[model samples]
Target: MFEKQQVIYLAGGCFWGVEAFISRLKGVNSTEVGYANGNDLAPTYEKVCSGKTGHAETVKATYNPKIIALDEILESFFKIIDPHTRNRQGPDIGTQYRTGIYWQEASQRDTVIKFLRKKQKESSERIVVEAHEISNFYPAEEYHQKYLEKNPQGYCHVDLNLIDDEEFDHLTKEEYEITQLSLTETPFSGKYDDFFEDGVYVDVVNGEVLFSSDDKFDSRCGWPAFSKPISEDAITKHRDFSHGTTRIEVRSAKANSHLGHLFHDGPGGSPRYCINSATLRFIPKQEFDKLQKDKY
Candidate 1:
């Protein structure tokens, strides 16, 4: 397999928060805080913070596209920054904290522009995020690198909890409504309702390993039926009384995504997890050989 690595510079308010958030992704090899799109050759934090250097505090990330695509990375950045607001992000309001996407490669421009166009349609307000080629970038001071990692209580606008799942970044409207809003898919109409592929099933939201093909069985149910989870801690069970009925609801611990209601009418009298196909991503054994390690 050909491994591809790409570098992209993004500034979303404070570099500390952006750096911390992006470093947690699956394919990110390294991240460095810097000042980008600036006039100064080697801008420092003091100069950039003054808003006179024409630079924005940014993070340069080297990522493996084979593991996570550029689109996913861009979408994750969007989720944290307010694209409509110009020259600011979170609590930091200045040119230094402005949101921008600086590409190092010409081939990446098309994808970046297309993503912005799609984001524009989804947004009602005009986008203020700057999309341009990187003219100059100067790495920030040594202390600025991984600032959040050094100081856990440091100030940051990006809430680590509110970030969207990179794995399901391009989820369809139906999938989002079902997974995020706890809506149920149509009975027996799901793609994996009767699928019995030999592989592992993971949480669509956070990429956490959830179920295995060995535990999956056809239960004549509308959703994918799993007799058991890969581990007891993989899922959290709660008493769900929604939809005018009482049932056990299962959600992924890492993502808090609603899988489906649990019933005891499964094979061998085991609890059948009638999981929604929209909330679960199945990776068959043949295709999973290369990505056996869990992303989460």
Candidate 2:
């Protein structure tokens, strides 16, 4: 039997763009434009625009979790909306334009919080996006539903072209520099430099398992230090000649993304793999097991 469908309410500026972009995702079953989390029981687009309805233009997205996780959806949502800005996105400036994640399930709260925390660390500005249980949701007028599909030239705040740009599209600015441009992050500045959570680190560009916590050790080198990767085939080593020094650089085998470097100086003669946190995504042991179980 197929897994039950999952739903997530997303309010990212105008609902038209949110619906347009979210509906096109691979696992998305459907999307509906709506006014959500409003005090007024009877909500109309006109009332929402007037800033009295307390409703944000939201998109109700239903997707198959087996194909796409909630974190992926949240990550995609961030790409289209400005989380740092309050009550505004692109040209729209109103209370209804505020971005939010209104979830239905309590289980999703932890995931949302974790994702937001990671996003907060990556951003220089305070994130203003709200995460809460949805109070009320009302379907928008029939005319407003799938507005972009009906009117191709409709004004949309989101850049729909980003969906097609797979390479370096999902990566952040620092991640792109570290992975694609082969730039090393500053010492002691990465998120995972001091973090020793029980999890597996995967390539940021692609979800390819690279290292595990079992192989991780405190090298005090101001980077995430690992004794070895999960598998020898998971990574490729290259001779780096940058900065007038010879160093063995580590890169993900699948995406060929620049990870960090390999050093022979480690405890007990084991090679130390100093990796950039920006170039990796850590999945906790429980979550990893759940993901593996969900696959089959």
Candidate 3:
């Protein structure tokens, strides 16, 4: 049987770096550097660089859907590019350097647009990445093809290591990155934020029980809020001043994976334990005791 393939175009800063970054994905069949969403049918590197061709440096990613989902690809794209910055990514500047996702197929078009809207809710900064129907795309010159692979030391604002498939027990790539890499999920985006099932949440990286259902509360933090950990020994705290503030960073004791942060404000006498949903896996109360004592 012939293999099925899907194509999508992404323009995030420099095409050279963007092309190289995506070329490493698992399902990717091929990637080509190009200029897209411009009026000029014959846009060249020089003409686009002149900032008058109305072109954006773009990367055409062709991949097999049977291996990778469209939503996962879109999430991977969002992880590398800063959606809030307008008309620029990294040090590159001008219209050619702007970040965007252009689509052709109706299914891909809806997927891209839906992903963007979901991503926009996660950040306070305004999303500047454009989502548009495919207008035009001109393949870049041969020398620009796989420029980073040839140069090896070429410039890339993206951290390609973020997507590497590293097993974290039962965690997915996105879950692993969010837990081990300190990457935060969108606020109010976690499954347990408003969930009140009568069970507990355990560290995804390890089966160490962390938070009990009784302690879970609604803080409107968009994450699973707990009044406290199941016990003081269940978690560890470290000094975290990232994003320009001082706070206690929470991590699972057994897994040493980032859970979230501790805040002083809470409804009653307890401090609010704001946690990331990706870092914790939930166990329903009914099955909590049914599991083998050694497994949970």
Q: How close is candidate 2 to the true structure, as a TM-score?
A: 0.56
Tell me model 2's lDDT, rounded to 2 decimals: 0.85
Candidate 3 residue spans exceeding 4 A from truth: 165-296
TM-score versus the correct structure, for each prediction: 0.56, 0.56, 0.56
For residues 191-249, write the lDDT of model 2, one tens digit per residue: 99999899899999889999999899989999999999999989867655445478887
Please give, for residues 24-85, the per-residue lDDT of candidate 1 as tens digits: 66555457888998898878788888889999888998776756788999988888889999
Better of 2 and 3 by lDDT: 2
The residue pairs that clash in candidate 2, if any, are none
By lDDT, who's the top model here?
Answer: 2
**Candidate 2, residue 31: lDDT:** 73
Candidates 1 and 3 compared by lDDT, better number = 1
Global lDDT scores for all candidate models: 0.81, 0.85, 0.80
Supply the global lDDT for candidate 1. 0.81
- Angstrom error of the Cα, residue 184, model 1: value is 43
In candidate 2 the C-alpha lDDT for residue 10 amounts to 96
